[model samples]
Target: MEEEKYIGYIKYEGNLVEDGLMDARKQAQALLGFDSALRHFIGKRAPDFRNLDFEIPVRIRKGSWEALIPETVGGWVQGGLGIVATAYFTKAAQKMAEKDFSDFGITDLFKHAISAIQWFVRIGKHMGDTAIRSFENVQFLEGNTLVAIPNDSGEYLYVPKKMLDLYTSCNPKILEKIAENIEEGRELTIGTIVNGKVEEVAIYAEEKGIFCEEEAEPEEDVLFPELVHGDDVVLEGEVTRENKTSNSMGFKYEEHILTAYPESGSVVRYKPLLFLKCRLYGTVSRLDEKGSIAARRPKLYVSHLEPLESDREEDDLFR
Candidate 1:
């Protein structure tokens, strides 16, 4: 039997997934163009890594976002005449091409190099390594590429213009059916939109706000470590005494009160605090109103954290 290969799309709140995919596409475009320009300069000749300005690590300011010079150079390389890397070439062509060196006599060396660069960039961007910010996914279908964008908190799949024809074949119901199956007898993943909007019921259950009795089974117990505080702490934690508050979900929560904090840290819970359901090391961000400490949560990820000791212990004892 021929297995049907399906391309899925997820639409999330703030359109993060889509935004991420778009950012990747934009970066890919810029990088591909720059690579083309470089190849044009080194066409029919072996690529000289010494002479090629692949990308320079040019740090701007004391602590600003550090992007490769190729990013800037690529921007320059794009010109008015549909010239992809013209902007970069006009500004620093002489300087970039100053040192001449050559190696690897590959045919269509420039084209091949550009293609390779694009592949790496695409993979890196989709894997969330680049600066282009959109929460979306990309897939190739029927000789056309599709970028799925989010609408509301619900997951919506999208495809490139070339993919519209396959819409009938790509039924959205298939996704819902698959999701239903995944959620059976299982806690929901955070940030997974069903029909749009955050899965509040699932989130609350995961947070231990509901569906937990005094003598709930150990497996049902929601145990998360208290967040670690401090900028270097990496995991965003707030030393809030347990307090009462209403979350975005409109339900009053008895969660530990979190105050002004900076950075996203490790997630104490198995599910994410945000709409997206995934365990990742994140820093807590301080939510303030009128410059006053309001609440903390909705953190960003700096890096993954070590698994909680409890997790290790469980693994050892169980498995």
Candidate 2:
């Protein structure tokens, strides 16, 4: 309960805690979301948090439903790296020794990160069709641990590599359980607290885009055997499969089946054409080693997917 050692919290309020009571089962279920979200958040920003052997202890306090992460806990691993406060380490000293972070309290960096995410969540929740700059043009200055992100306005933003991973860390499906906590008659807020101030960003019941709906991590390399190299080929195909969990998909091309993976956010805009015929512009990235090294049973790294304007007549042919 020490304010100086207090790092962060996932505090819930509103209807769920109006009476200062929550069911044991519901509380445990809610902890599932807290577990994943907190670990994922910290693990991305600090790699050592994932490597720690013991579970990070988070004590839930009474009243408004608070799960506080104490920063004073020491974490020991197989390498005898007795790192304490694995989750609350600042970006300035994420990979460095504890002395690097001891100079200042954990308020500034921790507060800024939570505050920034809160700002982003608020913007994402209300963002409709308004266009924003995509990460496609973001060029970074290479680094061992940190990189500098360049904006179109010619300003350089220095960000740690682990922090940069946050951009690709979101999995919308992973949030369904968390979002369910806020029911029709209930209200909730998931936020970080520094010192004692809770963030103002709240996830409402009707919010749709709070969590970015993009493709999660994909597994293609290890799923199959070795894929022989092949030349780039542009082909028209029907997306036979689309997996929200992974970026990989089944593509039907000219009576031949191909494994297709979208580049960037191509699938997001072209979802309407998933089961229909579409023109694909991409390289035949990999070929089946079990078959001829030719384009037979190829795998595609698609950069563009265009739905065919003309036809539903031959749609059954792809089936």
Candidate 3:
């Protein structure tokens, strides 16, 4: 292995107001004897970039907001009453980028500013109480006993091995050995840390202890019928209604369409409340002993169609 060598770069933010104000006060005496237009120009014209010296040299570091100036100026800073102030403030940044490229040979301005601008936005949001809210909710089911706790602040520090061990201790009836049968599943809930970051796992029964199984490749199930026309075939909506003659339970869907099987489920949009126009596929699971639907209504099954020869040939070029 060879050692890598890298060059160091420094970003500068020059202070104009403090230095300019001091110089303006000194230059007022010289401006008094000039013509009215010159006097006004002298009073208003800000000094050039070369002359001003900044009191503070804010260093750009890992968590620094130095990178966010460009984005803010381009996005929110260009509008409203403070436009003049925003323009004046960001001018230094524009000049600084030019100076950086000339002096340090850095060519890409956008890439360099991205990290800084993101940090600045993050800090601004955090300071203004707009930080994103993430909950740490957990539901642990050991045998038959179910324990659910809401973690709003992400402070669930202790997850004992014993908690997992109790799965076999209680020997719940509904518990299945999903790990043994299924190759891969994540048992841990979303947002919870497994080994510093979030991990996936599943819950099932064991002889003496409940255990976590790492993710594994899942076995694919073969669907009947090679190809169907249109994008509806691709969506593969959930099967809600099974093939059945009469529906005793009141289902409040706007329109119900019957399929070959009565107990098959209905396919709605991805979100239940959203009413986007999409197709729903349906199929019926076999009925239970009581003649009631063993599975719920609107059970949609997506039929996977094999591609035509032309489609496959066309895809090869893109791939």
Candidate 4:
């Protein structure tokens, strides 16, 4: 973390950038997506590294109209990777590596950022529920449901978890926000400086459609579509109880424990993930006749289950 060197840079060309100008709104949004992408890249390794700040100094090519983040965006702050920013990021990176995140640092986050974006590009299309076999550094049974990520050096322990959060930046919702300035003639270059050179990922306007969301039907229970959702029907929680014979587990989201009946994939892969945070995707049970008269915790007919980052240790609540 050197004050003289940039950890990463976002370069924009064409349209406004060609004229030595940038739209303030688009700049902010691009930064938001950029910041979000970086956060996701480091989330699994540093789940609680929330308050982070970096000095984004605006730089312009001397003759060409290529614009890095604009000075107006930084706004009167003589911007550069100042001493304060460097020390802060360095100390934080060291702390994370010492505790839960072994061999991970702020620079490694930029490196993974490139990897995540490239992996998304490699998949070509969203796999959705179609089971995916191992594809390089990643393997998944369903969207966000990773099966394994093992490497020779044991480097990929957190990759799948990284991908889970990386989805936040790649989804159509975030794409549109980041691509607001993108048009037929415009181009975006997102890169991370590794060593002395830059590893760039080009984002073309035409290629933006490739990141578009696929069409799919909404999920609803066949028997009970209108049943009141128990506890506002949140599908995320810790596994408080499990019934191995029946392949059912109790999903605890605070005080309420909802009965969760997971599908086959979940049955096979979910037991080891108990006590960790999980997001179960499926339909909540409808309020039946007997339960209609009284309140009860709803049941989750789980179609898929994906574990969150491994940080929280099993404790009294999980037991």
**Candidate 4 wrong stretches, greater than 4 Å:** 1-4, 51-103, 121-172, 212-319
Q: Between 1 and 4, whose TM-score is larger?
A: 4
Indicate whether candidate 2 or candidate 3 has the larger lDDT: 2
User: Best by lDDT, which number?
Assistant: 2
TM-score of each: 0.20, 0.43, 0.15, 0.40
| Deviation in Å, model 3, residue 47 alpha carbon | 82
Candidates, ranked, TM-score:
2, 4, 1, 3
* lDDT (0 to 1) per candidate: 0.29, 0.52, 0.25, 0.51
lDDT of 1 by residue, 1-319 (tens): 9632211111111222223232444334434433343344343233233343443222221121111222233233223223424443343345545532223222223323333332322322222122223344445455665555442234454444322332222222212211221211222221212233332212112222221111222322222223323233333232211111211121112332222212232222222222221122435433345553333333232344233333233322211
- Estimate, for each residue in 156-245, the C-alpha lDDT of model 4 and write its tens digit: 433355464455344534344454556556676665555667676665654443443222224333423343564334357776545434
Off by over 4 Å in 2: 1-5, 71-120, 126-165, 195-197, 208-319
Go through the candidates in order and give the C-alpha RMSD of each one to the true structure: 20.8, 12.1, 25.9, 15.7
Model 3, span 1-319: residue lDDT tens: 9532111112211232222232333233212211121212212223331232211111222321111112122232224324553555466456766553332111122222222222222222222111212223555555534443332223342232232232222222111222122111212110112123432222212110112122232322422223221223232222222111222111112343212221333321111211122333333333335765442222223332122233233322211
Model 1 lowest lDDT segment of ten: 243-252
Which candidate has the top score in TM-score? 2
- Residue 284 local lDDT, model 2: 62
